[model samples]
Target: MKVVKRLIGQRCLGIEINARGELMGLQVLVDKKDNVVLGEELTGMNEIQAFLDEHPLTPIALSVSSDEIIYSRTDQQLDDQSMSDLLRQEVPSFDPEDFLICYLDGFYGFARKEAISEHTSALSAYADQVVLLGFGPIPAYNLALTLREETSDRLTVGSYQFDLNDTDVQEITPQDLEVGGLTVAAHQVPAFLVAIGYFQGGLGMMGYPFAKNDENLWYGMLLNKLWKPVLFSILALLMVNSALFLHFNSLNQELNEQSVLMQNLSDRRATLASYIEQNRQIARLGERESAFAIISDQIGATVPAAVTMEQLVLSPQSADRRAESAYQKEKVLLQGITTDLKAFSLWVNRLEGMPWVSRVASQKLTETNGVTRFELALIRHVEES
Candidate 1:
């Protein structure tokens, strides 16, 4: 014999299979997130499997029975008569006692508004969560209140009201709020906000089934799958980037310190050079002053009383050791004339033999009517006596 499963309303639907893999029954669940079901049916399993294979159902947990499969659809576009017809066609030969049927028509137009409302009210007694999905303003809004009132303390209803006139879904009201109970907190807004946010940004919404019994896929399964790894990777990259930035900053600081040190060294070198040049200039000036003083003293000491100098000139020569030794000694040239030749010759001998003087040379003596004229060159020792 073929097994059967049946489900009622737009809640989550599931099938329960026996140990032999034969279909036992079907459960129509109200709470999709928690895996809570409203009602179930038992019928032929083989026929239900064949029907499901032909018209694929959304993947969800199921509660199977002896001979039936139970399920529900939230898409309100399916009309009541059409839904009834489809169920008949799907389970062609099912016993009335073995079949249970229910549906949610919140998304349907105003034509099936009464029928959908009646069905929702009837199912609220047993269902754990009832969802009202719709586009219009009036019927959808009305259904929201009705689900809340009917479910009361027993069940929670999530009203997903899509505004057909407006391009976006304006507001989502949780079922727990309308019944004066503790609603899902605002922190839970992120997941719902993200889903709606994507819809607003032009990405369509895709539903994934989550089972309450299965701990892994329960809370924000779809969101966790997509965002957890990505968030972790980004955090890790930011940490690595921060470390690298700090390393480069340290290196730059070190380079700046080295640059300052080099500049300081260069400044010290330039200062030393300036000091050396100044010292050389001071030494040269001192030597020049000493030489002038010595020459003045010698000229005074060698002057004779009868030989008055007519003109005296002193000129300095280059101090080249090699040239001075090879040729003649460098001296200061003194040009002059005197009235007496003998007196001038005596003065020349005294100037040549002076202690500070190295040597003295004279041009040939010339006497013109008792006026003796001659030039004398005196070489002074550069070293101290």
Candidate 2:
């Protein structure tokens, strides 16, 4: 007999239920020959909510047992109707509505409706996608079918046997045994069966796999497997968009407020610029009026009675609009005749005591006729900028 090679890239999550009904998962890898069970792993069943949170994408295959599975056999060849009637007779407590009956060449299988619903629900909680749903010890029998071809003589797993000569499958007391240099441990049979069952179910050979669903394959798979991922993806995308919209709106409001403030400050600065020159001219006039008053009082207080002024000249330069100057200082020139030089000298010394006089000098001194003639020039103190 020619052996078909296993699809090398094929892999699945093989799962079985414990006595507590908790799931035990194994990662199975397929090679050219038998399917390999790599190791046991922490199942996503208890952590179903977390799986939905983080990894809503991994596929799952489950070998579940929630129903009362009854085995029956018919000696006469049976049609679909007869097989259904025969299965009911074999398990009297079974109802057609609550249970689905499966027949494979006169071998009958029965499982309750509620059991399948519960099993698939539990599987979806762990994975959004259920790649395959298989029931009872069927995957084990699926393995047995493959092993029979490999051994060629007789192959056994626990109490189940895969015989080359016999068409019918049978069960005996399970034990650990070595066949063709391979040791089949009793405890390892369940996991091994699940992996082989998943492997064969994926292969789609002759369709009499351990579990068979003749009618509702498409509806059952779509409702359980693909719905959740599509729904969750949409919701997460909407939340991100909403947050971004709010952040942009806040920045726009702040930008508008700053623009208004900047425009107001620019208008105020333009209005103040027109009055700049007017303010400077008025301020300069006030300072010159105060200085002239101080000078007049000092000259009258220090002048000598013997001196008679022939001429007096005070020249004060005004702020020139063309030069754009803020203010200009004043200078003094006096011409007088004195009967005595002693009086003239005394008068000059007293003028030096005034705050505004920086320097006093006699520009001319001469004896003409009966009186002495003199010319005096004065420099006024100017404030630094």
Candidate 3:
């Protein structure tokens, strides 16, 4: 509260038309601690305007003469239409439109539009805002409440006076109280109290809203009202965005980590596939070696005493081709020297009759001296269906 008061740095120039028909003005300055510092009273409009010119930024509160203002108190709230009807009925001499009405805390104050205009115009040039404080000791009552001062049965302001018989009574003397370290007299209480209340920002409840003269000041008040909430909303949005960014950032990092893990698994899978293929190749070669051994043993056993074996080729490559001899994977080529042709023919027939032999075809036959050089293809036999 102190910091807020300091930031506002409010100064109120309270100009009251006292009961004595004298225009009295007092300027009250409220410190950061809400202490009231009162200025000496100025007697006329000239003096008040001069003081206002010196402090052009201050707000003014005009307390019109009690005779010119109509006030009423109620125990319940009244809407604008109801209040308007009441004001018209009470002051039948003038229309409700001619009066500026203000209601607060069950208290209503009505002032003639002309009277307010005349008072505000005199000081409007020097002040930013002007408020009607209305008639009576209401301002004084609020100030006394703020100071926690004991209430008296009666309170007076200049020639105007009012009785507080309905209020809870306390028998303390008004002289015993000290306001802002200054001793105040009983008669000066009303004016000084009003000024103090205005300075302390306590007059907002009782001030007449229609009395505020400047549009710029109203806009400024609106800005002050909207400022804090807007700032808080912006800050909240920034915090939400920051939190979302962090959450997504973490998710992205986790996804990257998962991708790396998947890549490693894929690489391992490829290596495993390569090893499996190599193992299959080796197993096929082992089966081929076993088949080659079995076939070579059968061929050697079929050889007769007259035939001397020279060379044998199984599944010979294309490079070993002889004239008119085409290579077949299932055929075995045999080359030998045979002294007796009949024995060689019987040997071929014997080999062909074997269960594993498909058929035997004679590829080449040559003779050199008494020895015979021959080439034969021994095709394996197939069983009849």
Candidate 4:
């Protein structure tokens, strides 16, 4: 409640009409703690209005002289709505609506609405709202509560003195007013304390009933206090959401870029694999060609001049009737005509001496015409030979 009062920035402009018919005004701005922001003995309507203009947009608490108000005490418990009904039941001669009613303690004070409007309408132009619109010493009741350290049930200021109660106040004569307890001369009672009471009363610290329309002002002040922080919180949430969205969007874009890079790397790896396979095939073909060249050179160097070579085949297909042509082995087949069989026999023995030739077999030997025709098969060792 104290925080709410501070947030609404509730201030009070307490004006009292003195015995001399001069307008005495005091302005007080309330916070978590009580502070008399401005205190001046304002006289005349122009001075009051100017004083009020100095602190614009503050609630006003006007206190008229006791003579202007009709005071009554109610024995029964009453509410704001029933105050007028109670006044009408008590004073049936006049209309209850014609007066602005204020109930404090057990007493109800009724001031003519026209009389209050005449003085307040002009002053109201300078104030934001009206907190209290009736009674002279009403504000002093709250002032006594505020000054708890000062044990005074009565307050005297200016020419008039008022007896203060827990929820009531009564104007008394100078002789009837008590000794120096909480007395302030020079119209100081209503000047400072009344302004402070306006704040307290409006804040619901004291149960003094104000004008009914001031309820709207109270609600408006509450709304004014609440909406600023709510709006700021909404804006803060929006900023956080926007920041998160931007952060996630940045990460998403980076992920997409990484995916594309990964795909490009994958394609490059596949191309490298294909190149390695082609290089392996080329290496195998080169090895086979080198092996064939070495075997042909060894065969040419071991040949005999007495034997005429007609045909020579390495790793020949088998010619056996039982075996298919698909079967082949590491063997050399030679068909030739030799004029001297003795030279052939000597050449065969030399061929068997070679490391590559395991054995040489003579398959056929026949005298055809004047040349001796022979067919030989040379078997090679298991490996490349």
Candidate 5:
């Protein structure tokens, strides 16, 4: 056996090991100030025994693999009976009132029965944490009953039971409680602690699924393990979604309001347009009234005593009419005495020369009952000046 030593003060200690059982490393626990506290090593029982022997007075502690410590001598046999026999040989002797012992295993063989019976006398002296590995139907059932009596208040067994027959090594089952309030088979108490970051190595090496059987309980534990961060994430997502929904809803409402406003504006614009058109028509009617008045005054002033106005007509220019003729001519018919063609011509010329009249022409001249009548045309100007 090779021995390595490092002096360190009080602190939590850790050890690492490789697959091959060899002492490969050693270190002293150091703080930020480079002060040493605990010592660590990757070594076996020989080194541990030596260290303990040398530091008999000092409070020395050794961290061991849960599996390795419990099943150290039985690795080659692999059978429950053989492993039980090995445990009987290797397990430390117990002293009642000073120690307490509890076994966790899937089954018990002959050796387990002997070990349990022998250790029962000093079970109280054993540490709170003790476990056995392997599975058997008779052993499990028997152990369940025994644990009920032994660990009634301070300890429990198989409260959470893993199926010893399960090869997948993933299945776990919670133990059903009997008349007592104690949970003897619930593996969750230990496994849950591990998942929640309470326990790290040794007996806490198992993951959630391997330690719990109830799917809901398993999931609950997992969620609880990650509860803080998961809860925060869910809350953040809900807040973001709510904000987005509110924003879109507000935008929709605003759009609807704008649409209504635009519709009202459009209706008002249409009404205003109609009013403007009506006003335009009214202005045009007023201008036409003023033009008619001027034409009436000019016609009355231009007509001679020999000519009598029979009918006068005014109308808008026609599309088919010559542009100049349309703007400059108004049809007029006269029925009165005119001495001769010369007199008719003179009256026509005078009417044409009037400020508000033009384009005078005589289309007919007839003598009847010793009176001369003529039909003429004249143009009315829009503005008097």
Candidate 6:
């Protein structure tokens, strides 16, 4: 309610006839811009386009000269029946069809239909969606809602303020509110605020299409004419959303199919890996068996005549490993019991000295009741160089 009651004015486009009664310039008041452009500048539609270029899609209130309109306040707050009777008695010259009549209960505004049509047609050429078309200087009494001798309704233009009503009831002068530049001057702001009370100023308007029949209620500006476009917009939005949903659903299905295919490929890869490991083990065992015979003959030649050996064993160092040769590497194990520790040491040193031996160590070395029981292993050497 405060939004309506505050007497605010937005961008207003004012039109008027010249002194010669020819279609004249347009006065543009945009957002109370203090730098108001006046006569001769808006000679054509150029000014209107220029204003719109700067302030696009701004709501425009049209203010015409007050001489073009007839405004009055009745003695009593008239009902429709009383209003018709009063209008008939007061203004018998007015034909309802020749003129457009717009009124609140007490305040009324009327203009000739032919003249308004001409003004509107010219305005429609220059602008769009003209919301409020009224006489420029609006009545303060209408907004105040009462006529008091002490109270006054005044509208300021360039250097002067005009009286909307003579003594009691008032109407705003329809002088175009002029706003010139992008930056409005501070002193020129007050007049625009006053014009606000008149533009969408809650006064009854003759030509404005979307004004309320009774008051400035929110729904008053929205006529029954607006329903079809709003309905079509909603329907169009729903259709777009449905199309997008179908598209994304198909994409999701494709993604799921690709995911399943990937999982199958991963399982196949694991099976192939296991098969390769089994082949590696079989190849390593073949190499170990083939090398066992050669290693046994070499062990027989290396052993001293003084030592006896048992539990002779030879095996490849890694069964699961792949090798380029049948006799890649092997570990040799031998056991013996000897009374001479010095002779055992000499034999161990000889085993280490062999080029095939990587390392030599005893797995078990035990002496009991003057006899020594021992084990030794010689691992095959592998050098990159």
Best candidate, lDDT-wise?
Answer: 3
Model 3 clash number: 4
What's the distance in Å from true for residue 11, model 4? 3.4
Clashes of each: 40, 1, 4, 0, 24, 15
Could you give me the TM-score of model 3 versus the true structure?
Answer: 0.44
Model 2 ranges off by over 4 Å: 1-8, 18-22, 31-40, 47-55, 74-97, 101-106, 116-121, 124-128, 152-154, 162-188, 202-385
Q: Each prediction's Cα lDDT score? A: 0.43, 0.58, 0.63, 0.62, 0.40, 0.54
**Candidate 6 backbone clash number:** 15
In model 3, which range of ten residues has the least summed lDDT?
A: 168-177
Q: State the lDDT at 341 in candidate 3.
A: 93
Model 3 C-alpha lDDT per residue in residues 1-385, reported as the tens digit of each score:
3344456655566777654556777676666566767666677878877776665545667665556666666655566766776666777675666776655434566778677666555555654467446455456545544443444646443333334434332323334236546766554555566566555453433224434543444345445756898999999999999999999999999999999999999999999999997987687568547767887788888799999988887766566567323445567888889999999889888887888777776657798998888898877643221
**Segments in model 6 whose C-alpha atoms lie over 4 Å from true places:** 1-223, 290-293, 313-331, 337-350, 363-372, 383-385
| lDDT per residue as tens, model 1, 1-385 | 0011111112222332332344332333323233323343434555444534443332233221122223333334454466555555666663333333323332222212333233333222222221212222222233333455454422322334443323233335543233223233322222222222211222111121121322322222344444778898999999999999999999999999999999999999999999987987688567656666777776876787776655544435455546423333246666667876777778878877777677875466677886776777777665431
For candidate 3, what's the RMSD? 11.5
The most accurate candidate by TM-score is 4
TM-score of 4: 0.55
Where model 5 places Cα greater than 4 Å from the true spot, the runs are 1-221, 226-231, 245-260, 316-340, 354-385
Looking at candidate 1, the ten consecutive residues that score lowest on lDDT are 1-10
**Model 6 agreement with the true structure over 109-191: per-residue lDDT tens digits:** 67776776665565564344445554433332333333323345654443235354432443233333343223323232223
Model 2 alpha-carbon miss at residue 39, Å? 4.7
Off by over 4 Å in 1: 1-245, 261-283, 309-330, 340-343, 361-370, 383-385
Residues forming the 10-long window of minimal summed lDDT in candidate 2 = 1-10
